[model samples]
Target: MQRLFGFMCLVLIATAVPASAQERLKVVASFSILGDFVRNVGGDRVSVTTLVGPEGDAHVYSPTPADAKKIADAKLIFINGLGFEGWLPRLVQSSGSKATVVTATTYITPLKLGSHADPHAWQTVVNAKTYINNIRVALSAAAPADAEVFKSNAEAYRAKLDALEGEIGQFIGQIPSHRRKLITNHEAFGYFAKEYGFEFIAPVGVSTEAEPSARDIAAIITQIKKAKIPAIFLENLSDPRLIKRIAAETGAKVGGTLYSDSLTDEKGDAPTYIDMVRHNIRTLRTALEGVTMRG
Candidate 1:
């Protein structure tokens, strides 16, 4: 009888330990990029649900009933919030989620494209640091028990970001100023261009959902010819046809497909935020280097 009681107690303890270890903060990130940030900061302490998955465009994303259920179940919801997720407010309201909503882009100065704020602030490494910091604060506040863990994780991630920034600067510096121009499918690279000293021209506006008018395409073609821009890029989330059209008209080569607003799936080249930035810069370097060699 004594032996049987001891065995039962051991089994109960074993089951309880796993349950406690498995308990994690429930969080939802509006997109994959932000989801990466949360996972880095939250580490094993969070279970993150991303509404917009890998290679998915958030600008035109339609939330479903399943998405609403995820939102309702989340303890916290993170958004990019420089008007990036236009559909977020309605979705949150409809779901009636009591979860705390945190805007990861808060406190950073945003680059403006005319009257609209350019929401792709994370394109720049400096802005990305701010985003990580914001996410750290949100996670810390949500789970004070793991605040130290979040802080440590954020610091480590920031160091990586610092290194990435240095890499980008050094790489872009190698390209001659005249050869630093880029023509992409959309104006998603404004923040990147502003930070890296490149002139990025696009046919469509900030949002990918915005259709490029005939005049817009004509204007970009004219700019490409007048500026003698050497390389044009296709965005992963955009229609390559428009960029191909522009490239054909201007005789400018299509550099490569850039991961703009979303990350590639797990098995693809850009599986993480750091990988995405590195891949883009590497792609840019290769194409721009070719143009310089030709020139």
Candidate 2:
């Protein structure tokens, strides 16, 4: 009778314990956006550490000794490849990590800017789905026992992405074709522009670290005037002075800030990948919908 009672107690305790009670896989994401993706797919099965925090620029990020420690301790390291993190190679070497490096943009057809493959592929909702798929596969491979959990989370997240894409299209549809053109802080929105049928002009190149020369700024100012671009918006990761100066020179309104390259913290507008896309499109629509394009 005591044995039966003990068996019943053991079963109850086992049933009461949550699935998340299992040991979590430690993973490191190169940046905040990738960190968010890992969290959504990984759920409670993984602990993610982002090397670059929210609103932090990855283009010019300098890896620290602490980051090296994080890498050494991780079972997997996720990054946005296409030369996004130039500092990652050295960091990995220094850390002597055996962690599997997963490139989130593995299946993406990259957009070229000059001689560089644009690294801001996450700007478009479609490519963001690809990222989620890649992360899901990687996570499943790392933790086969939790494959079903990862799969379910990824499918649900992809559905949300599809809905987000529809929402973006609806917002863009409301804007006039000619008025769809705008000037951004940098060349980070090529994928977004291509996917949604918008024209984005920028003074600087793909990498935020690249500064626009006088000639470059002058060229952008000329283009904005000639094309009658509606607004110039500031990017969260970029210096606002350049965009502000362009807006001042061309009489284009300074549209609200756009979250590019990095996301804002939890209290800010864009805390997650989906939130980032929604915030950008809404900001664009609000700025361009009422403006009339003159030839």
Tens digits of per-residue lDDT, candidate 2, 165-213, equal 8988888888888888887767788998998889988744333456666
Highest-lDDT candidate: 2
lDDT of 2 at 5: 100
By TM-score, how accurate is candidate 1?
A: 0.86
Q: Lowest-lDDT window of 10 residues in candidate 2? A: 203-212
lDDT of 1 by residue, 119-178 (tens): 999998899999999999999999998899999999999999989988888778888998
Clashes by residue pair, model 1 = none
Alpha-carbon TM-score of each model against the true structure: 0.86, 0.86
CA displacement after TM-score superposition, residue 247 of candidate 1 (Å): 5.3
lDDT of 2 at 163: 95
RMSD of each: 4.0, 4.4
Give the local distance difference test score of model 1: 0.87
Candidate 2 ranges beyond 4 A from true positions: 1-16, 204-220, 234-251, 291-295
Alpha-carbon shift of residue 150 in model 2 (angstroms)? 0.5
